[model samples]
Target: MSNYPINPSTIAAPHSQSPLGANISSASLTTEQEFETGIRIIRDAYRKKIATKDAEIDALYKDLRRRDAEIQ
Candidate 1:
């Protein structure tokens, strides 16, 4: 419910755990457009990696099938 934005600067340095015993420096803020574009790029890269893995799995299955047919 708090309207305040959260970042390193806004966060309270935990009194008991902080080595510096102080809050961290301000974090770099990202614009909405920049954030969305970054997210999209990351998603595309992840999807591509998954697709490549799927293709490799399919190739392994095909090789197994071929070997089984040869044995039979």
Candidate 2:
């Protein structure tokens, strides 16, 4: 046998035509736009969540310092 590996597609049975095959080109643009929009929304939400958490931690830290000074 030759050293070259056999291609699986050549040996595999034919698959039924996919529904998305014809519309893939057109669908890809819309899919990409949606994907980008989703990413932007997720990033914005994540940033907001982190900022809120940081603010909460800062407030708690300030309270702890004040309590410590009162005790002393």
Candidate 3:
């Protein structure tokens, strides 16, 4: 057989490490601190929404009062 160069592709190397959170670790990632942080985030969102809605409701109420006064 004529001298044929060995293919480098045929050589095997150590298995490459997999990306993180490819399995059960992802589910276990949450801990007590994370839970608290998530709760805080959600509460802040709701509080902001409530504050905005309160302002909108107050504006609507004032508009309604003005309409009533106009009618009178």
Tens digits of per-residue lDDT for model 1, 1-72: 999777887677544333221222423333454466567778999999999999999999999999999999
Deviation (Å) of 2 in candidate 1: 28
Best by lDDT: 2
Residue lDDT tens for model 2, 1-72 = 999999977784554333433434543345455566667778999999999999999999999999999999
Root-mean-square deviation of Cα positions for candidate 3 versus the true structure, in angstroms: 11.7
Q: How many backbone clashes does candidate 3 have?
A: 0
TM-score of each: 0.57, 0.57, 0.57
Q: Higher TM-score: candidate 1 or 3?
A: 1
**lDDT-best of 2 and 3:** 2
lDDT of 3 by residue, 1-72 (tens): 769998989976544323332333444444454566567778999999999999999999999999999999
TM-score of predicted model 1? 0.57
RMSD of each: 10.0, 7.8, 11.7
lDDT of 1: 0.67
